[model samples]
Target: MKIIAAGLLLMNVAFGQTQLRSLRAVPVPEPSGLSEYVRDKASLIRLGKVFFWDMQAGSDGVTACATCHFHAGADHRPQNSLVDPNSPFRVNAELSTVLFPLYLLSDPRNRNSAMVRDSGVRVGSAGTFRRIFEGIVPGQAAELGRDALDKPEFMRGDMQVRRVTPRNTPSVFNTVYYVRNFWDGRAGRTFDGFTVTGANEAEGPGVLVARNGGLERQRVRIDKASLAAQAVGPALDHLEMSYAGRTWPMLAKKLLSLPPLALQKVAIDDSVLGPLARKEGRGLEEQHTYFAMIQSAFEPKFWESSERLNAAGELDPMGEFTQVGHNFSLFWGLALQAYQSTLNSDASPFDRFMEGDSHALTPQEQEGMRLFQNAAGCTRCHNGAEFSAAAFNENGSTRADSFERTGVRPVGDDIGSGNGAFKSIGLRNVEFTGPYFHNGGQSTLEQVVDFYRRGGDFAPITGDLRAFAATPGQTAAIVAFLKALSDDRVRYERAPFDHPELCVPVGHEEDESGELKPGDVATSAAERWRGLAAVGAGGNAAPLQTFDEMLRKFGENGERAHTMNEACTASLASLLGR
Candidate 1:
């Protein structure tokens, strides 16, 4: 019955930076002079949340930004999460516990020993069908898209399933602190208000802004707004959400005409959208268009011009849009970042303990913290208030990008950040964001620990990883400490973390031979999906499940080591800590 007290500790983080135990003390890097562009911050956040969850935002009318980022700001679905990385999204298959640690060795300690498994199939989120963008169908959520002519990889006979992303999806919660977003640091430190790769785009014409009665190519350069930069990317990617040839103006045109969160139900008590929610059914009470939300959030110069911009999408050659519709990218990106900025999970048990609550963490968990800081060498990358070297405010030096070549895979495979260096991601809410790493090869936090214990899978250019001997007790303690990082608010979808309802596609009815399970789209139902019910600011009845819990439920019938039946999820949730 030994009691442990967590005293406040200050330590030097990576690259000559200092960080305190209490994360709230760290100031997130925000773009100043925002008042010139933003009209109302609250309205901007509301617009962001609604846009993130609205199915109408997707060209297919189903795949919203929240589809890949619902659970704790990251995807947790196991079915159709894997893709062939070597071939670069050649297949989208169900990932299982049996096939993991993609590149494995027979001897854990030996790197040159006989290989057990080397799978090219990496874990990622499933996205849109293979289709070409035609035009905004005016009042329709779906763009007037035609099926692609090419023989697509993600297919069951003639039926087109969803394509998977080559990279694993990261959480959007703490991204406001990142100097650059994505595994590849393509989402640059500065946002030009147009594209994610705006920094490296050779000083091209920047984001288009509406002036008196004409379009002006605004040379916008807002620093520390990488979240805004990253926010605009997936919305137009052919595999992620849009059809081929869909442009910003076209997508914007569609969204401006539609009602906010039209296809989804908003909780009446929602922190941001509650007052706007309808009294009895789906959508908001005002029945206002997304354009109205934009008007409420952004400055008049960005949207109030009388100019009409021609649609740039190939299929929508005849389509013309208003000034507000044309600059949708800038509005969407900034607003989403504004909403995500409030999503920082600084209320974990570890945070409370650091802020002077001794009983916040168990003694074993405190011991785990010590090992994590010292013996485990976790702080070399996972350091600072944000728990990531990639955090802009973490390091005094220019290492906030924190792109390290840890040799998880060969440099020739992906060439991330130029030389196989991936961004060192933050570790907050890690308990809920499993399937770890950029490839998402690990299933649980324990497996992630095991990966580090063995000095990583590939080692041609290992960063700071080296073999370490840790006992079972030490490992358990470390894992418990990791779990302590889970913020109660995020786990229950409370306050700023709450959102509208969403229906994410799980998988299609298909066999191993890539054949459909008979019937039409309704019967065979490749579009088989699951609903994530709306949670208000008051929070849900139970906390969200860890990745493994949902993974096992989605696993093959009776193949999961734990579950007797998949339907037992809700009943067993009580025993499983929600």
Candidate 2:
């Protein structure tokens, strides 16, 4: 009878739906030893939010981690967003309506006939212009630099445009559940607090935590802190945030001199920072120094030490550095992780339905849920509450399940999962994260569904994808079901998702002024800024646009996806020949 019951439960799981709230998130492991690094969790979270949104943190003083993540935890700007893999500059193509469905078949029903269009242009976030580092201009959130002739492809006429990241950024929402982060899982589960990779991969002595009346180089492996590990990479990455040769110490020294959010305004009703907010106008009223925030949020051992260190982080014979200045990266990574962990969005319509609110979902959405689990078999890989097999509770013992090859791209040597493996990102707010896939090839959820429904666009198949036919109504219902996972809080920038004003570089224009700026390299691309107004805990009234909505000219092109198949590879092999 017990065996029969077990079999029955398995059957139910196979066909029945599972609620997102049922599964446990990957535990956010604190840094080892030192008891706890945080003296005040609330203060620490506030610090994290400030760091994550502080544009001054960038070498140019105009970018932030929030720049790429401003829209529902993913980028949706249509201009200068497409990446052509063959381009030496890495990206130059602009996104447009006709260029989508990246690998479209002439016939939606047929796997092979003749290719109608394959733009080879994909989506990506635009970052800073490539320039050799000089040094920070004293007392400013900017750098002094001379330009070098970077890749000629990056050059447009006499000016150079901003560079684009190679991969499509995954949403940061509900990322606390992932065992590993990033498309290739380069951001490991154990944060080292120093290296770009995980602690296990760190080469040097690791994070410098003060000990025994003096500073010490100790290797601290904070478990379940992939978010921390992930947070450390982009800060110094010349392509992403910093100038070439920018060091954490340099960044720290610059920030320590400035008050919290000295470059931007803080909302009076900010979810986390409101208590520290100014009574009127911009910035905090108290002039909370980064040093003070660190001192309050972290233990005395972290910031109380007066150890003088050089740019290399070595104890200098003659130098002026505080423990806070030397170990800023560690604080930055962990605090950012703390803030991101709070960005959970488990309150969507589907979540409400799972919580016993039957009317939360429409009748068709309910049927779509049935099809997603039973017919579509989406639950097999996208199991658990997070709708991701990559969630730690679902695949703790295996790294392979952390990735899958829907065959979005071709196999290549040493290329990150170049055989098309990518992170099985959670689909909580799929409506807003546009230009789907690691390649950022597909433009809308409908386009994504169509890619999956007819079979993924690539070949040499072997994975969780295969062609299966669905009626138009069934397809629409599945899309509707996916949309039901979106949380209104995320959509409206409420509470944990609310952020400070950030000026993001959306595109480039001619340097019409023809005047050299402090960081200008050979008349670097005159940037165009898209200013985001700060939101508070109360959230915004305007609804964020879906990727489909953002791509206004795409029409109804968002209405397609490949069907999920448990065993259809042998049939698709010839159809999608390598």
Candidate 3:
């Protein structure tokens, strides 16, 4: 009788029509561990929030942490969704399939991995890996120059077209629950996944060093687990936040410039840049300005205070603080995490039905759920708590794995599946995170279901599940269940943002030749120093390289430096200049 009931239930689910109802999102809780810091000490999480919202930290003040991540419901949108072309700042604001780098902060508790490089650079070699390093390689810089040279118009100092980052910025919400970060699961263990508590610590040992008669590999114990170890990578990534192209001294110099009150209040490593600049007999004040600018970029309150002055009440502040940057970073990280923490889609009608809520799911929805678990093979990888194992594998390639193909072309090196194979995502908020697939090829939910129904994304016939073989009616039922996962109440907030001031201002124009506009400044303190350093370091150093030069040297060489930095910085300056 039980077996008969189960089969009947499946049949009803498949055949019945169901009305879609909206689900309310559970309220998210605040982050903990704030009071643990010393008296009046700001928690890293708080700082992260402030930093996330502060757009001044970037070259264009208009871009904040929210700019990329957007709201939790949106899945850091613009990923294949297309952007408003009329917008001057962002020509194409698509979400990437990869993650970017993070900069280093002078927290005493943080440590980083030693730069490791193998003598040989081979593509597609098994067990081979590559790590981004601090120093700009000659080949890389030259390529950047070429790209700059090519896109003279949009690539100009004040009007850059941002490059599509290698990876998509994952939603930082609920990230705390995951043990790892990034598609490859490389960053979670070392840095407490994103908390400032571990800010001063070194990265986990996942690297191997090979030298003459000496090859030692250091493996981290944390990698054995998943959820507890994923937040560490963003702390050191160049593309995400940490210093890219610039060095510790450069970053330190920027930090030291914050107002003295700001500087003394927080305990950053003063020695990294201070002592080095002093020893070199270089004026540390410029470096100080750089740091101050970075702080000012993030924290508006820290910059506005006039505490560093004499009896006459002159506003001659001593230190520099990008206070806005720090606060927003903490804020965004925590808020996103907070929301994500509450992202329990377990209460779906389908789940309630399983828990004896007879009215939880309509007949059609129940059939959809059963089909999802059984005949549809949807539950194969999309199972468990998150509906995904967070593991990477070919969901059956569009062609070889199945007979049907959706005509979606495979991206570069789509070799079956590899370590970086896209991790299976939970379907909790699947509706909001389209266009679907790792590369985001499919634009609609029906299209996605159709892709699977077709057995694979591409053409050529083979494999057991080759013909998704589902009738049109069955496909509709499954899609209906998928649609039920959408939660509309999850709102998004657009935070205000501005640009950061660069050390040396540069010229810019919107014309095609990448030439400087009239009234545009030509030099910056950073540029001067960078030029001198380049020349002193044996490269022909020009105080300012044209946009054309920057792109060619950096863009095409596969170095993928943030090409938009110069333009964003210039744009910020223009706004401030106004």
Candidate 4:
């Protein structure tokens, strides 16, 4: 009778018993022995939040982690999102206000059909300056040029016009649950204090060579901190945030001396930093320096020097100072992780529905959920409480070990992880995160549904997408379900989601050849850095809201409004007009 009941339950669920059983939010583990390293978790989170948004952390003193992830933890800017036309995954060649869906071959069913010309959308990217390098490998130091410091190359010439990322930016919200990060899963689960390459592949000693010539690596074992692992990638990434030949030590040295969030204002009532602001009664520049904050957050053993004084009583710059420089990278990584770990948006309508509030979801949304589980089979890849198989749960305390080829593009083009296998990202805030997929080929959820409806554009489709077939109404239902996943806390500035001010780059100035000139780079940097220096000089600086907040603050004019709802409506209207 028990066996029969189990079979009946499996029959009732659309995605079968296995998938239904997988859905549940797992609590993020607080880093063990964190208290030994950090004076207080809240203080560390506060410091981390400041560092995450601080433009001074970048080599150009402009880009921040928040620069690419300001809008609901994902990028929203459309300009400079275009990729090279010759790229195998290239969707479109033209730059326009609107991005169209990916072009399909003549026969919609044939995955290998020559894609239609002029049919792809512009990919989203972080607007960053360029560094000129003669012959530097990706992970090694470059031979510094004579003008490396003074006249450092700033996104000039034909090759350096728009700083577009190769892949679309994924949201950092709820990333603590992800076993690995990045679309390619290059950022591993085990952070080895330095590289994203996990324990097995990382080449460096895990120990922190101390200021007193003592080495320690086993003192802290930060497990389940993939977000910390992911935080270290973009700092030195030439395309994402750094100039050519920029080292981790260089970034560390610059930030240690400068004020945190030097380019942006901090709100007086910021949830994390409110106490600090209240005590100081001043903004970021006046209240605190990165050095002080780092010292406050970490143990003195990590930063204090034990070097013997010389005859002139001057400490060696290269000897004991190198340990402090290395400590900066460690603090940056772990602190960012500490801040981002609190970014779990688990209070969605769907969450309420799962918690026994049947009426939490509207009838349409419930129907969409039903379709997603059974007919759409979205749960095959996007399962569990975070709505992704890539996420870890308490019940299933194992690293997510699956990547799928969704047949979005040809196998030959950018064969990530051997034949187009991309990590299945969590879909919690799918509505706000536009230009979906690794390539950003689909501008709207409707297009994504259509792509699945036609069984995808590529051959050898994997997961439940192999059998996916949805009507227009069903697709709409699925989209409605996805919208229900959005949390109100994320929509509003509240608690953990509430953040300090940011001066995100909107668009870049282009030269005649469509390359970014040095003036353009300086102008972009200046725009972000404005009011930063003055804040230290007792100037009243207003906090800069994100692009989305600014858009909603001003009337939702065509130029300002870039929400998913607006984009979807425009896409539907364009389709109808066509």
Candidate 5:
């Protein structure tokens, strides 16, 4: 019976039914138990909320789970500018749009293609990026310096450092329902019947190993329990929070051991530590006080043993205790997972527009949606309620053991999309998450569309996939639909972070340049074209060529096929050129 079904699919393709095949809408589970911690118990959510923003969870007090998996609720960073450039990053632009390099340069690959040159020069996509890090003035130094590289609240005993994380952070907003975590589903695995399947799948180290540009094939079932369990990866990942050295248990104990006398005398009203510090003085001491306040803010009554503790003489007048309860760590995971479960955005206007709400979307948006679902073939992978398929495949027909290459395969020991390929990210709340793509290769929504329309990755240095091309205007409609996915209401905002007491001369100064510098030459037309080719050559060139050929197969204009050059995205060029 399975063989017969496969045969029919082939016959359908032969009969030109490939384009006519109807997409099946997979059912997404409703938000359940997610509200168990947040719906009515705002206090529990309140605790979770504070923890989400608390950078002290990491060893250095500089990083947080949120640092990479930012609440902007989308993929993190574009063009890998957020990290030290000596450590590079790359991605397939079509699968993502919001993470493009807004102020960084495309990585240069040295293959010969229609779009790139083998100059062996590594240039940033954003001219000002390097300058931002190196700093031209004092204020610039303060803004970009990595002085307080670790979290101020974390105990030094909790510090741990490892290799850079293998993949970009996925948004946590609507992750409650997801079974697997990480781009390659490397978390959530269980030891046996004791663990959830999804948890088991995501439990290993963050890196993915591909066999012949494919993942190891296997069947796995996922559930919300697994999603909740998988949420702990960052807290333990050395490159992320690196809390493994100072497990939540250790962190809790350390924070509990601090002398209340010092904490109390630290004065909620000291010049540098006062609650009103934000209004009056602005100094390093004030920031340190703020971090202390955040740690001390959790009401003592809710956490203390009250009457029992008083009888035993174990409680303080301020109702504080000397030790944190074991439940605190368990509660941390519970609250986080529960809150993430509610991150569903299925009720978007675009969803309604597709469900027969003719007025839900503007005509332009409606046309764009149509293009996304049908003409552009984007629905092949980004097809469900969350706007992506968890199932891995090679193209639409071939079953493969590895994750999708998106044709960004690198050349000559470059090790492009081998062990480094990421999972397909869901398209939700895309507008606020600038610098799109897994490795953040592209910088804008239109640029992402242009990438897909042209095909997948291009080799920037080697010019490996320079022959790939896309139809003009085909990507514009797709870009329109992606823009509609933005949810401004949920966009995360950064609260003031100050830790003056942590001002102990700060950590080691980084020698490498950072993103958003001021003196670099701006990306030009020629540079962008070379960038496109560079991206293709760096990844799976086969699909890049195949997809571009498919675009031409649909009769898109060939003469207008000038590749992106400099940093001017097609959409930007359209407006700037005019």
Candidate 6:
């Protein structure tokens, strides 16, 4: 019976029923859990945007959320984006692209194999300077230097430098639809106004100060705010964004006193800054402190009395904690969630096609769409408006087809719910979000399609791929269909997606022993600023290259470029028509 069904599917493809299906339109919903203190949703969104890109938010006063998510909602910097040496699937000897066919999986230590050049696991780049110690240590925070390189502790190896995150950085675009954020789905659906596990545990100040001076623990119970829960994860994560021993209170204190984007320039017409916009300038400005923004965006009750008084009868930065100070995690989480919730990329070509605009997608794209739903079996996991089964339903229920074990790695390498199961990420802007997969083991869409074609590299695969076969043309059509998921506003950095200038580390400076020194990491801010000067005189932040441009610049002889119709054709030749 199964064989007959497969034969019938093939027959349907032969009879040209591929273009019969269309993607459903998933409308972007308003963010949940806005406090009564917030007078304007638009103002709150602006505050979220500012905080999202503000460098002062980091302990080093340089790194921002935008550092890793700079290009097309995903990191595009090639240097320093390599896998750790101890990683189970470590293949590349150094930082380089992961090539096709002979991927790094069979042997963990085989670096001298004959395969495509620059094909290794691509991890996201992070801050080079971190707290000198491994874990939380008292007095370490005071020893931190503004310039990590100049700090004797870091220079002499007393402090540990930042290391690559275990998994690749997922794009923040359209993340509002996720039922649970993170590859492990650790960010729960219920934001407890505190930690990711707050839903299960009921220990924290579960209430907020009411506008009329009343206090209650249940004032803020955010639902479907996984992005908010996910937002606070990186701020405290030692590997991704913070120094060890750093608490939300410490980060909040540091940010409250410092001016937002102190190290970078804010465009005068920045949507987030509005009336608070300072003169077109660089460096820190006297106006628009994070404290002021927080006060304006939130109810006065949340921040006005949340501080503890010191011996001198003044509010202390670290003396005592209040519901507001403790609620910094809540504010940080929700503000980011509010901003990211607006990053819906529903204006893609495929979106138009789904909305009944018949000519929005080309005939080839239409054919590809059909193949995506039928022959490719992509609809099994990537169904609905977001092209992902993990997305929240219109009625707010989570679809059961969320996580799957595609066998990207061997079964026991990184064990979780199903040994190797990872989130089925949305395909929107997939062309820009590469090296594919949670481990970033594949470099292009063709490689991704090929992986699915072979039913994954390891055993115990989750999805059925027995009927999942396609020709080269069919694969190319599928790639085209994926590209149609990209939204143009994201490519141009327009409105809700607009961000401040960010200086991101491209590579690390090597020490005497070839170890990465804290100060040796190179940043793109100066170069980006120079580029911004050459082309324009306005206050709008400069735009980074689209994924296509990055591919052309980084790929060998344009063979590795993205978005081009033939980009994956050559690499996929040997695997086609299987």
Say which candidate scores most in lDDT. Answer: 1
Worst 10 residues of 3 by lDDT: 120-129
Judging by TM-score against the true structure, name the best candidate: 1
Q: Where does the lowest 10-residue lDDT sum fall in candidate 2?
A: 560-569
Return the candidate ranking by TM-score, descending: 1, 2, 4, 6, 5, 3
| TM value for model 6 | 0.77
User: Which model is ahead, 3 or 5, in terms of TM-score?
Assistant: 5
Model 6 clashing residue pairs (backbone): 37-299, 97-118, 97-119, 98-119, 98-120, 99-119, 132-159, 206-217, 207-217, 509-520
lDDT of 5: 0.36
Candidate 1: 10-residue stretch with minimal lDDT? 568-577
Q: How far is candidate 5 from the true structure (C-alpha RMSD, Å)?
A: 17.1
What TM-score, computed on C-alpha atoms, does each candidate reach? 0.88, 0.87, 0.46, 0.78, 0.50, 0.77
Rate residue 381 of model 6 by lDDT: 81
Indicate the residue-level lDDT of 40 in model 2.
86
> CA lDDT of 505 in candidate 3?
18
Clashing pairs in 4: 91-120, 131-244, 161-516
lDDT of 2 by residue, 371-459 (tens): 88777767756766788877665334433345777767664411454566777778888887877888777777777777777676666
Better of 1 and 6 by TM-score: 1
lDDT of 3 by residue, 1-578 (tens): 55654764565445421211112221222223422211222222223333343323322222234344433322322212222212233222223322110111132111222322211111110000011233322211110111122333123353333333333345444343333444444443232323423333456322222224332333323221232233223333333433334322222223232321110111121211222122322223334443343342333332233233322222235633222222222323333343234333444555545444567677777778777877877755455334544421122111111111222333232322332244445566564444455444444566566656655533332223333556777887887777555333221111111111122112122335534333322221111100001011111111222122232343433232222232222233333222
- What are the candidates' C-alpha RMSDs? 5.9, 9.7, 18.7, 9.2, 17.1, 10.3
Against the true structure, candidate 4 has what lDDT?
A: 0.60
Candidate 6 per-residue C-alpha lDDT over 126-222 given as tens digits, one digit per residue, 9 for 90 to 100: 5535453232212121214333344232122333344566577889888888788888788887777677743645455454554455444454567
